[model samples]
Target: MSKGVIVGIDIGSTKICAVAGIMDEVGKVKILDIVEEPTQRGRVSNGTVVNLEFTAKDIDRILNVLSDKAEINIHNVIVNISGENVEGKAHQSFLTRDDSRSTIRKEEIERLAVDIRKSFRPTAGNIIIHTFPQEFIVDRAHVPDNPIGRFGITLGGNFFLISTPNDPHLALRRTIESVGVKVQNNHRFVPLKIVHTLFTPLADAMAVLSEIDKKLGVAVVNIGGDTTEIAIFQESGLRHISVIPFAGKSITNDLVKAFQILPDHAEKLKLIMGAIPPDEVGKNDIIKIPGVEGLPDKEIVAQNVSIIIEERVKEIASMVMAEIMHSGYDGQLISGVVLTGGTSNIAMIKEVFTKVTNGMNIRVGNTIRNIGQTAVAKIADPKYATVVGLVLSGFMPLDERVPEEVIWGDIPESQVSIGSYNNGFDTPNSKLNGKKEEPPQEEEQSGGGIFGWFKKKVSSAGKIDMGDDKNYTN
Candidate 1:
């Protein structure tokens, strides 16, 4: 009967959105309210911060609205980071005991993770954010997902590590902190997979699928303004995740180029005249829009506009299909593709998706869960899935295993010394020791175990609430 509220924020190049909700005893979230606002032009690019100040202000406004609507105190949030630079690479790590009599234990698993993290850095200044345990093996024998109790001399784990540019992580933390909210300890490392799989998943799972098709492999494509994120679901965990650079903004750019119009005007026209089927557009359907200076107000054919935009949309669809093929998911997705995001609202988007996916059954996903069937049908837009997914993930028991540590260093170009902080803070410091010295502890992380001291705190609380202080719950 007890409930606690948490917030989820997603900062993208085109828009910033926040959702607040309460988690029930079983760790299910009931969304309270969601707030969204557009990013000022040029403030953010491809999930990276181009203007910290403006981005902070925009996020501040959205948070304020969400807080008021939800009627809850907001301090920490689970944020989403997706872009070209945010990449997921698979790697395998093995831990060998010095003594043959030694057996593999959870501590050994933690050590192996620490070792894997060491080799994660790229020459281009990237910082590790999320880690996925693909599989674990003991004594050269494949083991099930759980290996804590098994006895073995060697512990091996296959991991998919996701990282982003150090600079973006730093800048985003600075912006979020400037808005007077503390980010979670594992803010950067929290995986979106956890959110999608745990909360509102049935809907996302059903986006392009029917109940009968659940057993068949299916992929969900979220084509947003800044990033196109893909998720493939098998029987259990997600098989693959990728962030592509192509999305709605590319179509907007195409409109600007082909129409010889200002970027803003082009975006507006595309929204009004945007449609997937060129045949549906009438030749006489002309929209009057302001033309460039020295030219009269122009009358443009809506069909011509549709053709140009559809061409780009088709290309994006093709790229996603290509990715699915390359992922070796061919004939794997029985349910076909589920398309969601703000860009999914484009006129005739479902038709386009259906055509591109060919034999696969496709449907627009709606983020309606726990709500009644009627409301689910009314709010059936795909654009809000991420925000809803954020709320869904927000409600799950927080992975208190890792306290917020400063993964990215000080923000460059600013003269601010920024105070003593750790991995919880995303932005880099402008000055250190008044000499710009690197923090010594960056190389030596505290909380030696993967589920460190912070996890112990949460686990202890759970035990007390269960009226059994002698037993710890994870």
Candidate 2:
């Protein structure tokens, strides 16, 4: 495949975001442009395309804006899809070797994956979007991280399958195509293919998680406008994924009803004053809101705002904790939970999570630290996590990737082979000969003083450095 720019488009419930970037020789992502526009009501819901015409127009507008800003004609994009309709299931497939003593080969593994894919049968109105291998079991006795050269008569392992309802899937595809851009085609075993639909939480995990985090077990919670997505990883693989139907929108609705305020005003108030308990908000502080129509203005105590937000946040946190427990990896996640997405920016969110999880460690996940560029402040918001992760997904090496073979429209399984996996493992030139290649090492810069630590923190926070210039805040 030719190397060039990669674009990641996040069609979210609240907004649509597009990120354009290029992966450098050293595998660093350099931002070219970022654009976002609100998703008008009824256009999209819970990450699924509901109105093709409206969505297509919005997608076209963002793509055109992004193209103009980046000075390139964007044709394809890696999109993220999420919602309650999107589901995940766990399954294990076994393959017996012809020779009991023969060692497992790369082709054998590839064939096993293909067989597993072919065996899956989605519901009548659904199609599989992604299939991920969690681990490899050899002879039902030994579990090897990589079973390429392991000798075993029987080979089997756990796999996680993600599927979405067909109606939304087809609607999303038609919306993209309606804009006159060809969706990137998926090829068997191709590396870093650009055109695919990714699970939103999975994409968010890829963008914020480190190698250690994945190996030690971690849960990523992406709280979006209308839904909250959860992805669990352990041993460098996906273990569990789920979408909570309630999220930031739920909190906004709660605020709207609690304060008897307009929906728009409630959203604005939530963003401005939302916080968990012990957030240092003064009880006597009052916030005035313009009344609807000709009604008199209302004065609400800041403490009341915190109280309303705290209750909703606690409920959400409890739900997340319940999901973690249900995943059966509750105590196994040494890396704890990484909260991300737009709602993660809420004040004292980490505290709420910690309280709900019985003092489990929690950290806010952001992509700013992973990006290698100076002017990335615009995309530093956690709201851009999925899109940033989608861009980063295009830069991952083949072996470390998963198949993003989206079943387009209602196309027959024969048209797009059921076993057509594009994770780069089936390529003829693949070097999966029982040897792992070391990733390219980056040169380190030395800095350890107090000032250096402060500088590093500032950089991680996506702040621009201007020597001798006064800092400003928005």
Candidate 3:
């Protein structure tokens, strides 16, 4: 209520990242901390908490570590949920009256969205995570980005429904609740949507498709650890989205298969070899790889490594390009392709992308603004986009823009009052909600690292004490 510090959690397969920041009176968000913890299995299949208990424990550990470092609470943080199954489809719905000439009001349009979502409810125990209103059409005329007040006989809207399996949803909810923290939101949105929101200046599906040179329609390719998300934009709105089930991990896996090495060694070799041309690598160039259990150490040809990686990268890029071409954009993404995510960090990836895509416009994406110069020099390292976007997304207050009165989905008919949970708010704690407390002495001492000076200033308030008194479990 007092413009509290905001936190963003991006739970990915490879790692769970937590970024916390506070906005000053002037409205600039200063990132306080960024922390990552490797998942026990290194990735969550299809974004579900397959191993719910293990995943929850890992999340708790990361939250504890970050809370200490940032000296902030993660209990009420804004988290982003993304995965292959999470999808967005544009649906057009309208309020039609048997008799024409009935003037439409803002409430009518609000109800229109609610009605649309209600129509698509799953018969099973699944949940719609997010309902995004894309644009409004009033009669024959187009309305503003979010049309609510315009008067018209018929109101139409383009909405996106994001859903997930009910079990995973329950697990995510129960896990966070178990840690004494409420799930602020489960934005069943995708990584690309977050990227578009955080970095509006870049080539968003709508921006590239509608605003950019027609010849250069853009393919926003986001390469993550286990999956690569490809979205095609032509003439401004999203045309298509496809998820390839291979990415950095695939390349890492390829190295293992070809060299008969362990994943760790293969991953290191993949990152070090970078993306190079198969032909450029000489056959005699050998690299030593550690021996596997019961096997002698091996010597592999660098050419073989290059050939293997190039083949995989080319195949993946081709799949993405095929998605773009299938979208039937007016021309090739003359603007070329804008890449982002961890896989984009592979050295010479841009070159490989160009070769694979027949030389379209290609470059890596970043949050050029928001991040400080010093942090930019360090954090601008592309792989941090989603985590950075998670932090930045908190700064944009979506609820403030929408009316507070309209309900977006069907209300459950539970015997107990669920009003407190209706509007994305938490219920006040009572004895029934027994809470736990963490020790104050475990809070990270601030003055020893990059943020040492900040720790000194905040702690110097002489009001600083061990944060063990907080209502959270260890």
lDDT, candidate 1, equals 0.58
lDDT of 1 by residue, 164-272 (tens): 6777676666556656632243232221111211112222442233433433667778887866777665433345666666788888888888877888888887777
Error of 3 at 108 (Å): 3.6
What TM-score do all the candidates reach, one by one? Answer: 0.70, 0.80, 0.71
Candidate 3 Cα misplacement greater than 4 A, ranges:
1-3, 96-106, 121-125, 144-149, 180-219, 232-239, 275-284, 326-336, 370-377, 397-474
Leading candidate by lDDT: 2
Q: Write the per-residue lDDT of candidate 3 for residues 256-292, one digit (tens) a residue.
A: 8777788889978987676554556676999888786
| Over 4 Å off, model 1 | 1-3, 24-27, 96-111, 119-124, 148-153, 181-216, 232-241, 275-279, 290-295, 369-380, 397-474
Query: How far off is residue 31 in model 1, in Å?
Result: 1.4
Per-residue lDDT of model 2, residues 192-269, tens digit only: 233667889888876788878988999999998888899999887787887777788888998889888988998888
- Pairs in clash, predicted candidate 2: 189-422
- Looking at model 1, which ten-residue stretch has the lowest summed lDDT? 464-473
TM-score of candidate 2 on Cα atoms, chains taken together: 0.80
The number of the candidate with the highest TM-score is 2
| Ten residues in sequence with the least summed lDDT for candidate 2 | 465-474
TM-score pick, better of 1 and 2: 2
